[model samples]
Target: LKAGVVEALKTVQYMGIPQMVVTSTRTEVALLKLARFNILSYFEDVLGGDQVSKGKPHPEPYITGANRLKVPTKNALVIEDSENGVKSGVAAGCMVLHMPDLINTKLEWNNVIYGALDSLESFPEWLSSKQFGMWV
Candidate 1:
């Protein structure tokens, strides 16, 4: 998970975009240890589950992240790997891109969620594609 997160951070860095990882993990000690291994400075902030009033499936977490970044929820783009994450983004009015997970997710929200992407490696490309517009 640490390596994957580092790679994901690198990818975002390559795109010259700022990011903040909002996690539902109980403890972020692993993140602190892993940060030394691959400190991709792109991640502006790293938030834990305890930081917000609610976890996934609620807007609070995502809203907290957007608020911390000083970016409105409407302009935020969330890349989540679980059904609950997807729901949280939708509830927050952010554009969500879901990475496939074991739990099947119903992405019923219109432009709130562009699509469920396949892999992290393909994420930047798919997100950059001119064919897909931002959430309205």
Candidate 2:
């Protein structure tokens, strides 16, 4: 996890929001990493590629996350760092906020992206801003 991710997650939890981890990594590896970071409790569920029939760029992973969270796909918000992840979220009918960790330019899939942020630290403030209302 990033420096402010835990704080952001805590804020979300405080606000009574439900969160789930949907990653392309294997289930055991993802759980191990989250446990190692001591952030496993922050998520209501942790889903991995192995849990789904298909991986990123396919909607299965994110759809499974929404199902596990008991939230409608349209009501879910996906924070993604990669094109494949963004695509998966979009395809699953979830709002995707792209904060690319590697790429510097806009992706060709920008049309589906709900918003773009410079860093994870901005996520909490962004969630509280009027822009979030407009987007949602």
Candidate 3:
């Protein structure tokens, strides 16, 4: 997890927003990562590679994520840190917020991404404020 992500997750949870993790990694690995941060309880579920027939950039992971949450892809918000993740979310018809952690984007992502954040800590504010209808 990135810095302040635990707090962000807790804050979103406190606000009663449903959250789920969509990752290309295997389900067990993703779960272990969340467990390492002690944030497993914050998400409803993790839609991982084990659960998807395809990986990031294919939209299957994100589609599965929305399905697991019982929400439409258009209504889902994806906070991503990688290029493939962003592409996957966009292809899935979800709003993607990019926050660079390990990968620094180079291509023209603004046209595809819903928003860019300096840090994951700001996601809750963006969700709470007048961001894309302010989560109405």
* lDDT tens digits, residue span 1-136, model 2: 6767887898778767888999999989999999998999988999988889999999999999998888888989898888789889999999888886866427666687788988888878878763444332
In order of lDDT, best first, we have 2, 3, 1
The digit string of per-residue lDDT tens for model 3 on 1-136 reads 5787887897788777789988788889999989987889999988778787889899988888888788888878888888888899999999888888858754698787788888977876866674444443
* Steric clashes per prediction: 0, 0, 0
- Computed on alpha carbons, the lDDT of every model, listed in order, comes to 0.72, 0.84, 0.82
Kindly indicate the candidate among 1 and 3 with the higher TM-score.
3
Name every residue pair that clashes in candidate 1. Answer: none
Candidate 3 total steric clashes:
0
Off by over 4 Å in 2: 105-107, 130-136
Name model 3 segments beyond 4 Å from true. Answer: 131-136
- TM-score of every model versus the real structure: 0.77, 0.90, 0.90
Candidate 3 versus the native: TM-score? 0.90
